[model samples]
Target: MPHAIKLYVRYVDAINRRIGRVVMYMIFAMMGILLYSSITKTFFLPSLWTLETAQFFMVGYFILGGAYSLQLGAHVRMDLLYGSWRDSTKAWVDLFTVLFLIFYLCILLYGGYSSTEYAIQYGERSYSSWRPYMAPIKIIMCIGIFLMLLQAIAEFFKDIAKLRGSEL
Candidate 1:
């Protein structure tokens, strides 16, 4: 609960909040695209871009929304043991659990870089006829993971604050 840590947490929180809010709006766009694609395929010419574009946007929806979901405590957890714990104990449990998230993110970021790099260098595309560049989706995934890592770090600090009887 030093000023610096609080500021860092706020910064990360703000980034996640802004990205999450913006990305959530894309769901409407996705819906419209899907509807348009359905109508087109059924009645008129089949649009090659619609389904693939929808997939990209759907990935954006889930990946970009991760930190927001964490903020809202929307991620599913088996809470039978967690629910009974006291605040400090709960904080301890959370601290431990977030380590796993951190590890996963680190691995994803490291391993994902090669695919992203390949996409960027070669302009990688899907095997589908549309052949949309794959980098954007992969890049978005990395960005989402980075955001989630930031949010997880903030949450870890919050847990520490709870353990120490300090407000963060």
Candidate 2:
């Protein structure tokens, strides 16, 4: 059972890591898109969609990369209080904190579903000159949220295993 749990945790970590690496390529794409937008607006004709498309890529970068950040312990925390703790104590604290994380994810998933549904049903689009459909971005946001929630479960499992001294 320990071995199975360990494998599961590693699988979850691997999934996030791989996706995070792939999503990072969007940074280069965003830069190129922004540069093209700037050149067009400055020299030729302004492409209205380019800037907003770049913003969506930025959102994707932050949202899709969230699990990798959490996996690396890169998320900001109160070091003054959390840093002084022992490993075992930290694991315990993390386990408790995950409850709040779970609550937050639940709310996001619930609220996001309705928003996504509305966007799809009404064929929502941006108010810009080059109106892009909102459904795809909302769908991607939901996927990112789900992946983050999965990562939180993986973390909670790791914390539980830590307390048992069979750290994954």
Candidate 3:
């Protein structure tokens, strides 16, 4: 592989790794919020913000961890035939299919950007009683999708290298 491509892969992988590690802790935050919700509902007036806040944390956790999941090959796949394929054969298939992933992510990112723009323009807020501003989470969603797109491209390059009997 060329030096620049190698560097790109390394950089994307590094960023995702760091972000994933940080995002992993968000599950605990979500759990804490839920626990507080349970406690509050049992003993006192229910908090409107807890449920919505927990939901936002869950969304952030899943979205932000996506690239790292891909990097780790932790995403699900139908393995009826795939599990038996040779490594090079798998690489070829992955290279071809990654194009579809790239295309889909492109569409998703575009839509996410449009929605985010609308949210910012209108100062959108969730419909919940808490009515939190939507821009921050929408922006985070866009960033996560963009990072996933970049990681997909890096995976494509890695597949190419693998087909050539090299690893990136």
TM-score of every candidate relative to the true structure: 0.95, 0.94, 0.99
Q: Give the TM-score of candidate 1.
A: 0.95
**True-vs-predicted CA distance for residue 50, candidate 2, Å:** 0.9
lDDT of 1 by residue, 1-168 (tens): 888999998899888999899999999999999999999989999999999899899999999999988977889988988888788888899999999998988898887888899999998989999888899899999889889988998998988998889877
Q: How far is candidate 2 from the true structure (C-alpha RMSD, Å)?
A: 1.4
Best by TM-score: 3
Instruction: Evaluate all candidate structures by whole-model CA lDDT and list the values in order.
Output: 0.90, 0.90, 0.97
Lowest lDDT block of 10, candidate 3 = 70-79
- Candidate 1 has its poorest 10 consecutive residues by lDDT at 81-90
Residues 1-168, candidate 3: write the lDDT tens digits. 999999999999999999999999999999999999999999999999999999999999999999999999999988999999999999999999999999999999999999999999999999988999999999999999999999999999999999999999
- Candidate with best lDDT: 3
Off by over 4 Å in 3: none
Which regions in candidate 2 have their CA more than 4 angstroms from the true location?
A: 1-4
Q: Cα miss at 43, model 2 (Å)?
A: 0.9
Candidate 3, pairs of clashing residues: none
Candidate 2 lDDT over 28-105, as tens digits, reads 999999999989999998988899999999988888999888888889999998888999999999999998998899
**Order the candidates by lDDT, highest first — what do you get?**
3, 1, 2
